[model samples]
Target: MLVVIGRIGRAHGIRGELAVDLRTDEPERRFAPGSSVVCAGRSLTVKAARPHSGKLLVTFDQVADRTAAEHLRGQVIEADVDPAELPEDDDAFYDHQLIGLRVARRDGAHVGEVTGVLHLPAHDTLAIDAEGREILVPFVAALVPEVDIERRVLVVADVPGLLDPDAAETVTPPEGR
Candidate 1:
Protein backbone atom coordinates (compact mmCIF):
# COMPACT_ATOMS: atom_id res chain seq x y z
CA MET A 1 0.00 0.00 0.00
CA LEU A 2 1.04 3.62 -0.55
CA VAL A 3 2.00 5.81 2.35
CA VAL A 4 2.34 9.57 2.06
CA ILE A 5 5.88 10.60 2.93
CA GLY A 6 6.06 14.24 1.92
CA ARG A 7 4.26 17.14 0.23
CA ILE A 8 5.75 19.20 -2.56
CA GLY A 9 5.92 22.90 -1.94
CA ARG A 10 6.48 25.78 -4.36
CA ALA A 11 9.20 25.70 -6.98
CA HIS A 12 12.52 26.64 -5.45
CA GLY A 13 14.47 28.00 -8.40
CA ILE A 14 14.49 27.89 -12.19
CA ARG A 15 15.96 24.37 -12.29
CA GLY A 16 12.63 22.60 -11.54
CA GLU A 17 13.55 21.93 -7.89
CA LEU A 18 10.70 22.11 -5.39
CA ALA A 19 10.71 22.43 -1.62
CA VAL A 20 9.46 19.35 0.21
CA ASP A 21 7.62 19.31 3.50
CA LEU A 22 8.60 15.95 4.95
CA ARG A 23 6.39 13.54 6.86
CA THR A 24 8.93 10.71 7.00
CA ASP A 25 11.83 10.36 9.41
CA GLU A 26 14.58 9.72 6.87
CA PRO A 27 14.21 12.21 4.06
CA GLU A 28 17.69 11.55 2.72
CA ARG A 29 16.86 7.93 2.13
CA ARG A 30 13.27 8.37 1.00
CA PHE A 31 13.97 11.30 -1.32
CA ALA A 32 17.30 10.10 -2.63
CA PRO A 33 18.12 10.35 -6.32
CA GLY A 34 16.38 7.82 -8.56
CA SER A 35 13.66 7.25 -5.95
CA SER A 36 10.27 7.05 -7.58
CA VAL A 37 7.37 8.54 -5.67
CA VAL A 38 3.76 9.01 -6.72
CA CYS A 39 2.75 12.67 -6.89
CA ALA A 40 -0.72 13.78 -7.87
CA GLY A 41 -1.45 10.24 -9.11
CA ARG A 42 1.61 10.33 -11.40
CA SER A 43 5.01 8.78 -10.82
CA LEU A 44 7.70 11.39 -10.36
CA THR A 45 11.19 10.00 -9.96
CA VAL A 46 13.64 12.04 -7.93
CA LYS A 47 16.30 13.34 -10.25
CA ALA A 48 18.27 14.99 -7.46
CA ALA A 49 17.94 15.84 -3.79
CA ARG A 50 19.86 18.37 -1.70
CA PRO A 51 19.63 20.20 1.57
CA HIS A 52 18.18 23.69 1.43
CA SER A 53 17.92 25.55 4.72
CA GLY A 54 15.74 23.29 6.90
CA LYS A 55 13.69 21.88 4.02
CA LEU A 56 14.61 19.48 1.24
CA LEU A 57 15.22 20.54 -2.36
CA VAL A 58 13.91 17.87 -4.70
CA THR A 59 14.09 17.73 -8.48
CA PHE A 60 11.65 15.49 -10.31
CA ASP A 61 12.41 13.75 -13.57
CA GLN A 62 9.12 14.89 -15.08
CA VAL A 63 9.71 18.50 -14.08
CA ALA A 64 12.18 20.24 -16.39
CA ASP A 65 11.43 23.88 -15.50
CA ARG A 66 10.09 26.05 -12.75
CA THR A 67 6.73 26.34 -14.53
CA ALA A 68 6.41 22.57 -14.68
CA ALA A 69 7.33 22.20 -11.04
CA GLU A 70 4.82 24.88 -10.07
CA HIS A 71 2.01 22.71 -11.37
CA LEU A 72 2.98 20.02 -8.85
CA ARG A 73 2.78 22.35 -5.86
CA GLY A 74 0.98 20.93 -2.87
CA GLN A 75 1.17 17.44 -4.36
CA VAL A 76 1.44 14.66 -1.83
CA ILE A 77 4.40 12.33 -2.39
CA GLU A 78 3.53 8.74 -1.71
CA ALA A 79 5.67 5.63 -1.74
CA ASP A 80 4.70 2.00 -1.94
CA VAL A 81 6.23 1.09 1.37
CA ASP A 82 6.29 -2.29 3.03
CA PRO A 83 5.51 -2.52 6.74
CA ALA A 84 8.84 -4.28 7.23
CA GLU A 85 10.67 -1.20 5.87
CA LEU A 86 9.30 0.94 8.71
CA PRO A 87 11.60 2.12 11.46
CA GLU A 88 12.74 -0.72 13.69
CA ASP A 89 13.58 1.47 16.69
CA ASP A 90 11.79 0.39 19.81
CA ASP A 91 10.66 3.93 20.58
CA ALA A 92 9.82 4.86 17.02
CA PHE A 93 6.36 4.10 15.69
CA TYR A 94 4.24 5.08 12.73
CA ASP A 95 1.23 7.32 13.26
CA HIS A 96 -1.15 4.60 12.14
CA GLN A 97 0.35 2.23 14.70
CA LEU A 98 -0.21 4.62 17.58
CA ILE A 99 -3.77 5.54 16.72
CA GLY A 100 -6.47 3.70 18.65
CA LEU A 101 -4.13 2.81 21.52
CA ARG A 102 -5.76 2.87 24.91
CA VAL A 103 -4.03 5.49 27.06
CA ALA A 104 -4.05 5.03 30.81
CA ARG A 105 -2.10 6.13 33.86
CA ARG A 106 0.24 3.85 35.75
CA ASP A 107 -2.37 3.67 38.50
CA GLY A 108 -4.82 2.19 35.98
CA ALA A 109 -6.78 5.38 35.45
CA HIS A 110 -8.11 5.33 31.92
CA VAL A 111 -7.12 8.64 30.32
CA GLY A 112 -8.37 8.27 26.80
CA GLU A 113 -7.98 6.70 23.39
CA VAL A 114 -5.37 7.89 20.90
CA THR A 115 -7.21 9.34 17.90
CA GLY A 116 -4.27 10.67 15.97
CA VAL A 117 -0.56 11.52 16.11
CA LEU A 118 0.64 15.03 15.37
CA HIS A 119 4.28 15.64 14.49
CA LEU A 120 5.48 19.10 15.41
CA PRO A 121 8.90 20.62 15.07
CA ALA A 122 9.75 19.51 18.59
CA HIS A 123 8.06 16.13 18.96
CA ASP A 124 5.04 13.98 18.25
CA THR A 125 1.93 14.54 20.32
CA LEU A 126 -0.83 12.02 20.79
CA ALA A 127 -4.32 13.36 20.26
CA ILE A 128 -6.52 11.57 22.76
CA ASP A 129 -10.28 11.61 23.07
CA ALA A 130 -11.00 11.42 26.78
CA GLU A 131 -14.61 11.56 27.82
CA GLY A 132 -15.54 14.14 25.20
CA ARG A 133 -12.40 16.16 25.96
CA GLU A 134 -9.47 16.31 23.62
CA ILE A 135 -6.27 15.73 25.59
CA LEU A 136 -2.91 16.33 24.01
CA VAL A 137 -0.34 13.93 25.37
CA PRO A 138 3.24 14.33 24.36
CA PHE A 139 4.74 11.17 22.93
CA VAL A 140 7.75 11.00 25.21
CA ALA A 141 9.44 8.34 27.27
CA ALA A 142 9.02 10.32 30.48
CA LEU A 143 5.29 10.72 29.97
CA VAL A 144 4.56 7.48 28.13
CA PRO A 145 6.52 4.56 29.55
CA GLU A 146 4.89 1.63 27.84
CA VAL A 147 3.42 0.91 24.42
CA ASP A 148 2.09 -2.60 23.96
CA ILE A 149 0.96 -2.79 20.35
CA GLU A 150 -0.35 -6.30 20.69
CA ARG A 151 -2.40 -5.29 23.71
CA ARG A 152 -3.35 -1.93 22.15
CA VAL A 153 -2.52 -0.08 25.33
CA LEU A 154 -0.21 2.80 26.28
CA VAL A 155 1.00 3.05 29.87
CA VAL A 156 1.39 6.66 30.91
CA ALA A 157 3.78 7.75 33.63
CA ASP A 158 2.59 9.10 36.94
CA VAL A 159 3.50 12.74 36.84
CA PRO A 160 2.00 15.11 39.39
CA GLY A 161 -0.80 17.16 37.84
CA LEU A 162 0.25 16.06 34.39
CA LEU A 163 -2.80 14.12 33.30
CA ASP A 164 -5.07 16.05 35.60
CA PRO A 165 -4.36 19.66 36.51
CA ASP A 166 -6.29 19.43 39.78
CA ALA A 167 -3.92 16.67 40.87
CA ALA A 168 -0.92 19.02 40.66
CA GLU A 169 0.34 20.41 43.96
CA THR A 170 -0.21 24.10 44.42
CA VAL A 171 3.37 25.26 44.86
CA THR A 172 2.29 28.88 45.19
CA PRO A 173 -1.15 30.43 45.09
CA PRO A 174 -1.97 33.25 42.74
CA GLU A 175 -0.74 36.60 44.01
CA GLY A 176 -4.14 38.29 43.66
CA ARG A 177 -6.13 35.28 44.84
Candidate 2:
Protein backbone atom coordinates (compact mmCIF):
# COMPACT_ATOMS: atom_id res chain seq x y z
CA MET A 1 0.00 0.00 0.00
CA LEU A 2 1.19 3.48 -0.82
CA VAL A 3 0.32 6.52 1.30
CA VAL A 4 0.96 10.16 0.50
CA ILE A 5 3.41 11.44 3.04
CA GLY A 6 4.19 14.91 1.73
CA ARG A 7 4.37 17.21 -1.25
CA ILE A 8 7.57 18.73 -2.52
CA GLY A 9 7.75 22.48 -2.43
CA ARG A 10 10.40 24.80 -3.90
CA ALA A 11 14.06 24.07 -3.50
CA HIS A 12 15.17 25.42 -0.14
CA GLY A 13 18.82 26.03 -0.89
CA ILE A 14 21.53 25.22 -3.42
CA ARG A 15 22.41 22.07 -1.47
CA GLY A 16 19.39 20.16 -2.85
CA GLU A 17 17.21 20.53 0.22
CA LEU A 18 13.52 21.06 -0.52
CA ALA A 19 10.65 22.34 1.55
CA VAL A 20 7.91 19.76 2.00
CA ASP A 21 4.27 20.18 2.93
CA LEU A 22 3.39 17.31 5.18
CA ARG A 23 0.32 15.20 4.45
CA THR A 24 0.90 12.50 7.01
CA ASP A 25 0.95 12.75 10.77
CA GLU A 26 3.91 10.44 11.14
CA PRO A 27 6.54 12.81 9.77
CA GLU A 28 9.26 11.49 12.06
CA ARG A 29 8.87 8.06 10.53
CA ARG A 30 8.02 9.17 7.01
CA PHE A 31 10.83 11.74 6.59
CA ALA A 32 13.32 10.17 8.92
CA PRO A 33 16.89 9.66 7.74
CA GLY A 34 17.40 6.63 5.50
CA SER A 35 13.65 6.41 4.73
CA SER A 36 12.82 5.77 1.10
CA VAL A 37 9.90 7.39 -0.68
CA VAL A 38 8.68 7.45 -4.25
CA CYS A 39 8.19 10.67 -6.13
CA ALA A 40 7.37 11.13 -9.78
CA GLY A 41 8.02 7.41 -10.42
CA ARG A 42 11.48 7.62 -8.88
CA SER A 43 12.52 6.14 -5.54
CA LEU A 44 14.41 8.66 -3.38
CA THR A 45 16.22 8.13 -0.13
CA VAL A 46 15.97 10.70 2.65
CA LYS A 47 19.34 12.06 3.67
CA ALA A 48 18.03 14.39 6.38
CA ALA A 49 14.90 16.21 7.48
CA ARG A 50 14.11 19.08 9.84
CA PRO A 51 11.26 21.40 10.69
CA HIS A 52 11.58 24.78 9.06
CA SER A 53 9.00 27.58 9.30
CA GLY A 54 5.99 25.23 9.66
CA LYS A 55 7.24 23.18 6.71
CA LEU A 56 9.75 20.37 6.58
CA LEU A 57 13.16 20.81 4.97
CA VAL A 58 14.21 17.48 3.53
CA THR A 59 17.23 16.43 1.55
CA PHE A 60 17.07 13.42 -0.75
CA ASP A 61 20.12 11.42 -1.77
CA GLN A 62 18.94 11.34 -5.37
CA VAL A 63 18.69 15.12 -5.59
CA ALA A 64 22.21 16.50 -5.71
CA ASP A 65 21.57 20.13 -6.61
CA ARG A 66 18.98 22.85 -6.85
CA THR A 67 18.13 21.83 -10.43
CA ALA A 68 17.37 18.30 -9.37
CA ALA A 69 15.21 19.50 -6.48
CA GLU A 70 13.45 21.92 -8.79
CA HIS A 71 12.51 19.03 -11.03
CA LEU A 72 10.70 17.43 -8.09
CA ARG A 73 8.79 20.55 -7.12
CA GLY A 74 5.03 20.08 -6.79
CA GLN A 75 5.46 16.33 -6.80
CA VAL A 76 3.86 14.20 -4.13
CA ILE A 77 6.03 11.94 -1.97
CA GLU A 78 4.54 8.54 -1.27
CA ALA A 79 5.79 5.82 1.05
CA ASP A 80 5.21 2.17 0.43
CA VAL A 81 3.86 0.70 3.64
CA ASP A 82 2.62 -2.67 4.78
CA PRO A 83 -1.08 -3.23 4.40
CA ALA A 84 -1.35 -4.62 7.90
CA GLU A 85 0.73 -1.88 9.51
CA LEU A 86 -1.20 0.35 11.91
CA PRO A 87 -0.40 3.56 13.74
CA GLU A 88 0.96 3.34 17.26
CA ASP A 89 -1.84 5.48 18.60
CA ASP A 90 -5.06 3.55 19.07
CA ASP A 91 -7.05 6.70 18.34
CA ALA A 92 -5.31 7.15 15.00
CA PHE A 93 -6.80 5.54 11.91
CA TYR A 94 -5.60 5.31 8.35
CA ASP A 95 -7.63 6.80 5.53
CA HIS A 96 -8.35 3.34 4.11
CA GLN A 97 -9.73 2.14 7.41
CA LEU A 98 -12.21 5.00 7.71
CA ILE A 99 -13.34 5.03 4.12
CA GLY A 100 -16.34 2.84 3.31
CA LEU A 101 -17.42 2.82 6.95
CA ARG A 102 -21.12 3.41 7.54
CA VAL A 103 -21.89 6.68 9.30
CA ALA A 104 -24.61 6.80 11.95
CA ARG A 105 -26.01 9.14 14.53
CA ARG A 106 -25.86 8.72 18.28
CA ASP A 107 -29.24 7.02 18.21
CA GLY A 108 -27.84 4.43 15.80
CA ALA A 109 -29.86 5.81 12.89
CA HIS A 110 -28.17 5.38 9.56
CA VAL A 111 -26.89 8.62 8.13
CA GLY A 112 -24.45 8.13 5.31
CA GLU A 113 -21.20 6.55 4.17
CA VAL A 114 -17.66 7.87 4.46
CA THR A 115 -16.36 8.33 0.97
CA GLY A 116 -13.02 9.99 1.68
CA VAL A 117 -10.76 11.53 4.28
CA LEU A 118 -9.35 15.02 3.79
CA HIS A 119 -6.00 15.70 5.38
CA LEU A 120 -6.18 19.38 6.11
CA PRO A 121 -3.42 21.40 7.74
CA ALA A 122 -5.21 21.59 11.06
CA HIS A 123 -6.94 18.21 11.15
CA ASP A 124 -8.57 15.47 9.15
CA THR A 125 -12.09 15.75 7.81
CA LEU A 126 -14.46 13.00 6.85
CA ALA A 127 -16.17 13.36 3.51
CA ILE A 128 -19.59 11.76 3.70
CA ASP A 129 -22.10 11.07 0.97
CA ALA A 130 -25.55 11.64 2.39
CA GLU A 131 -28.72 11.74 0.31
CA GLY A 132 -26.77 12.78 -2.74
CA ARG A 133 -25.05 15.61 -0.88
CA GLU A 134 -21.45 15.73 0.22
CA ILE A 135 -21.04 16.64 3.87
CA LEU A 136 -17.70 17.40 5.49
CA VAL A 137 -17.41 16.54 9.14
CA PRO A 138 -14.41 17.27 11.31
CA PHE A 139 -12.94 14.05 12.61
CA VAL A 140 -12.96 14.98 16.28
CA ALA A 141 -14.07 13.30 19.44
CA ALA A 142 -16.75 15.90 20.17
CA LEU A 143 -18.39 15.50 16.79
CA VAL A 144 -17.53 11.88 16.12
CA PRO A 145 -17.87 10.14 19.45
CA GLU A 146 -17.44 6.54 18.54
CA VAL A 147 -15.79 4.49 15.83
CA ASP A 148 -16.75 0.86 15.93
CA ILE A 149 -14.49 -0.78 13.39
CA GLU A 150 -15.83 -4.22 14.27
CA ARG A 151 -19.31 -3.06 13.33
CA ARG A 152 -17.96 -0.96 10.46
CA VAL A 153 -19.80 2.10 11.72
CA LEU A 154 -18.84 5.59 12.84
CA VAL A 155 -21.17 7.19 15.37
CA VAL A 156 -21.50 10.95 15.01
CA ALA A 157 -23.09 13.40 17.35
CA ASP A 158 -26.74 14.27 16.71
CA VAL A 159 -26.11 17.94 16.17
CA PRO A 160 -28.54 19.95 14.07
CA GLY A 161 -27.08 21.43 10.88
CA LEU A 162 -24.31 18.87 10.93
CA LEU A 163 -25.90 16.20 8.80
CA ASP A 164 -28.24 18.61 7.03
CA PRO A 165 -28.06 22.35 7.08
CA ASP A 166 -31.57 22.88 5.65
CA ALA A 167 -32.99 20.62 8.34
CA ALA A 168 -31.70 22.88 11.08
CA GLU A 169 -34.30 24.73 13.21
CA THR A 170 -34.99 28.31 12.15
CA VAL A 171 -37.19 31.00 13.66
CA THR A 172 -40.26 32.08 11.73
CA PRO A 173 -40.72 35.68 10.55
CA PRO A 174 -43.08 38.02 12.40
CA GLU A 175 -46.59 38.67 10.99
CA GLY A 176 -45.74 42.22 9.72
CA ARG A 177 -44.34 41.54 6.27
Candidate 3:
Protein backbone atom coordinates (compact mmCIF):
# COMPACT_ATOMS: atom_id res chain seq x y z
CA MET A 1 0.00 0.00 0.00
CA LEU A 2 1.06 3.57 -0.61
CA VAL A 3 2.25 5.11 2.64
CA VAL A 4 3.13 8.77 2.96
CA ILE A 5 6.83 9.08 3.78
CA GLY A 6 7.41 12.77 3.43
CA ARG A 7 6.30 16.07 1.93
CA ILE A 8 8.38 18.25 -0.38
CA GLY A 9 9.14 21.55 1.24
CA ARG A 10 11.10 24.36 -0.46
CA ALA A 11 13.78 24.15 -3.14
CA HIS A 12 17.20 23.66 -1.63
CA GLY A 13 19.93 25.86 -3.08
CA ILE A 14 20.39 26.05 -6.89
CA ARG A 15 20.54 22.30 -7.37
CA GLY A 16 17.63 20.07 -8.29
CA GLU A 17 17.35 19.06 -4.62
CA LEU A 18 14.20 19.76 -2.58
CA ALA A 19 13.78 19.94 1.17
CA VAL A 20 11.50 17.29 2.55
CA ASP A 21 9.72 17.00 5.88
CA LEU A 22 9.85 13.28 6.58
CA ARG A 23 6.73 11.68 8.06
CA THR A 24 8.22 8.26 8.54
CA ASP A 25 10.49 7.29 11.41
CA GLU A 26 13.05 5.68 9.10
CA PRO A 27 13.46 8.59 6.73
CA GLU A 28 17.23 8.18 6.51
CA ARG A 29 16.86 4.68 5.17
CA ARG A 30 13.53 5.07 3.34
CA PHE A 31 14.48 8.08 1.21
CA ALA A 32 17.95 6.89 0.29
CA PRO A 33 19.34 6.79 -3.23
CA GLY A 34 17.80 4.38 -5.77
CA SER A 35 14.53 4.37 -3.84
CA SER A 36 11.38 4.94 -5.86
CA VAL A 37 8.67 7.30 -4.69
CA VAL A 38 5.41 8.83 -5.88
CA CYS A 39 4.70 12.55 -5.62
CA ALA A 40 1.68 14.50 -6.74
CA GLY A 41 0.31 11.46 -8.57
CA ARG A 42 3.52 11.01 -10.54
CA SER A 43 6.18 8.39 -9.94
CA LEU A 44 9.71 9.66 -9.32
CA THR A 45 13.03 7.88 -9.10
CA VAL A 46 15.23 9.04 -6.28
CA LYS A 47 18.66 10.05 -7.52
CA ALA A 48 20.00 11.14 -4.14
CA ALA A 49 18.70 11.70 -0.63
CA ARG A 50 20.44 12.70 2.59
CA PRO A 51 19.40 13.78 6.03
CA HIS A 52 19.86 17.46 6.85
CA SER A 53 19.12 18.37 10.44
CA GLY A 54 15.56 17.21 11.20
CA LYS A 55 14.55 17.09 7.53
CA LEU A 56 15.75 15.36 4.37
CA LEU A 57 17.36 16.70 1.22
CA VAL A 58 16.13 14.82 -1.84
CA THR A 59 16.89 14.90 -5.53
CA PHE A 60 14.58 13.17 -7.97
CA ASP A 61 15.33 12.23 -11.54
CA GLN A 62 12.29 14.16 -12.70
CA VAL A 63 13.31 17.37 -10.96
CA ALA A 64 16.02 19.58 -12.48
CA ASP A 65 17.17 22.86 -10.92
CA ARG A 66 15.26 25.09 -8.50
CA THR A 67 12.45 25.86 -10.94
CA ALA A 68 11.45 22.23 -11.31
CA ALA A 69 11.82 21.52 -7.60
CA GLU A 70 9.66 24.50 -6.65
CA HIS A 71 6.69 22.97 -8.44
CA LEU A 72 6.93 19.90 -6.23
CA ARG A 73 6.79 21.83 -2.95
CA GLY A 74 3.93 20.92 -0.64
CA GLN A 75 3.45 17.66 -2.55
CA VAL A 76 3.34 14.48 -0.49
CA ILE A 77 5.81 11.71 -1.27
CA GLU A 78 4.47 8.20 -0.98
CA ALA A 79 6.08 4.79 -1.33
CA ASP A 80 4.95 1.19 -1.34
CA VAL A 81 5.71 -0.05 2.17
CA ASP A 82 5.75 -3.60 3.46
CA PRO A 83 3.21 -4.06 6.23
CA ALA A 84 5.49 -6.50 8.01
CA GLU A 85 8.11 -3.78 8.41
CA LEU A 86 5.75 -1.76 10.58
CA PRO A 87 5.80 -2.02 14.38
CA GLU A 88 3.62 -4.85 15.77
CA ASP A 89 4.04 -4.31 19.48
CA ASP A 90 1.04 -4.22 21.75
CA ASP A 91 -0.85 -0.92 22.10
CA ALA A 92 0.61 0.29 18.80
CA PHE A 93 -1.43 0.14 15.62
CA TYR A 94 -0.54 1.55 12.25
CA ASP A 95 -2.83 4.34 11.11
CA HIS A 96 -3.73 2.50 7.91
CA GLN A 97 -4.64 -0.64 9.82
CA LEU A 98 -6.99 1.31 12.07
CA ILE A 99 -8.95 2.78 9.19
CA GLY A 100 -12.33 1.21 8.36
CA LEU A 101 -12.48 -0.70 11.65
CA ARG A 102 -15.78 -0.63 13.51
CA VAL A 103 -15.63 1.16 16.86
CA ALA A 104 -17.73 -0.07 19.79
CA ARG A 105 -17.95 0.58 23.50
CA ARG A 106 -16.82 -2.00 26.04
CA ASP A 107 -20.51 -2.59 26.82
CA GLY A 108 -20.97 -3.55 23.14
CA ALA A 109 -22.59 -0.29 22.02
CA HIS A 110 -21.75 0.56 18.42
CA VAL A 111 -20.23 4.01 18.15
CA GLY A 112 -19.02 4.33 14.56
CA GLU A 113 -16.31 3.49 12.04
CA VAL A 114 -12.63 4.37 12.34
CA THR A 115 -12.32 7.00 9.65
CA GLY A 116 -9.01 8.64 10.54
CA VAL A 117 -6.11 8.74 12.99
CA LEU A 118 -4.62 12.02 14.02
CA HIS A 119 -0.96 12.03 15.14
CA LEU A 120 -0.50 14.88 17.53
CA PRO A 121 2.68 15.73 19.43
CA ALA A 122 0.92 15.09 22.71
CA HIS A 123 -1.04 11.98 21.82
CA ASP A 124 -2.70 10.08 19.00
CA THR A 125 -6.45 10.47 18.65
CA LEU A 126 -8.83 8.19 16.80
CA ALA A 127 -11.42 9.86 14.63
CA ILE A 128 -14.64 7.90 14.75
CA ASP A 129 -17.37 8.68 12.26
CA ALA A 130 -20.22 8.37 14.72
CA GLU A 131 -23.44 8.60 12.69
CA GLY A 132 -23.01 12.08 11.18
CA ARG A 133 -20.64 13.59 13.71
CA GLU A 134 -16.93 12.89 14.03
CA ILE A 135 -15.83 11.95 17.53
CA LEU A 136 -12.21 12.39 18.53
CA VAL A 137 -11.21 9.76 21.10
CA PRO A 138 -7.81 9.40 22.69
CA PHE A 139 -6.08 6.11 22.03
CA VAL A 140 -5.27 5.34 25.65
CA ALA A 141 -5.40 1.98 27.38
CA ALA A 142 -8.08 3.16 29.79
CA LEU A 143 -10.20 4.48 26.93
CA VAL A 144 -9.41 1.98 24.16
CA PRO A 145 -9.71 -1.48 25.61
CA GLU A 146 -9.07 -3.65 22.58
CA VAL A 147 -7.99 -3.48 18.94
CA ASP A 148 -8.85 -6.57 16.99
CA ILE A 149 -7.30 -6.07 13.57
CA GLU A 150 -8.43 -9.43 12.20
CA ARG A 151 -12.00 -8.70 13.24
CA ARG A 152 -11.69 -5.09 12.16
CA VAL A 153 -13.06 -3.71 15.38
CA LEU A 154 -11.86 -1.52 18.26
CA VAL A 155 -13.50 -1.74 21.68
CA VAL A 156 -13.42 1.42 23.75
CA ALA A 157 -14.76 2.13 27.22
CA ASP A 158 -17.30 4.96 27.04
CA VAL A 159 -15.91 7.98 28.88
CA PRO A 160 -18.48 10.44 30.12
CA GLY A 161 -18.56 13.69 28.08
CA LEU A 162 -16.23 12.16 25.48
CA LEU A 163 -18.49 12.58 22.44
CA ASP A 164 -20.79 15.37 23.61
CA PRO A 165 -19.50 18.80 22.62
CA ASP A 166 -21.83 20.58 25.10
CA ALA A 167 -20.62 18.32 27.89
CA ALA A 168 -17.01 19.08 26.98
CA GLU A 169 -17.50 22.76 27.82
CA THR A 170 -18.15 24.28 31.24
CA VAL A 171 -20.20 27.42 31.93
CA THR A 172 -18.49 30.19 33.91
CA PRO A 173 -20.56 31.96 36.58
CA PRO A 174 -21.31 35.66 35.97
CA GLU A 175 -18.80 37.83 37.83
CA GLY A 176 -21.17 40.69 38.73
CA ARG A 177 -24.73 39.39 39.15
Best by TM-score: 2
Summarize candidate 1's per-residue lDDT along 40-101 as a digit string, tens digits: 98888999998888889999889999999999988778887776555656676777778899
Task: Give each model's clash number.
Answer: 0, 0, 0
Estimated TM-score per prediction? 0.69, 0.78, 0.71
Model 1 stretches with alpha carbons more than 4 Å out = 71-75, 119-124, 138-146, 156-177
- Model 3, C-alpha of 144: deviation from truth (Å): 6.7
Q: In model 3, what lDDT does residue 81 have?
A: 73
Comparing 1 and 2 by TM-score, which wins? 2
- The per-prediction CA RMSD against the true structure, in angstroms, equals 4.1, 4.0, 4.0
lDDT of 2 by residue, 4-112 (tens): 7888889998999999998777999999999999999989999999999999999999899999999998888889988788867778787888999999998889899
Per-residue accuracy of model 3 over 68-146 as CA lDDT, tens digit each: 9998888878888777656435555667989999998887789899999875444578999999899999988888889
Residue 108's lDDT within candidate 2 is 84
- In candidate 2, how many clashes are counted? 0
Residue-pair clashes, model 3:
0
| Candidate number with greatest lDDT | 2
Candidate 3, after superposition: displacement of residue 3 in Å?
1.3
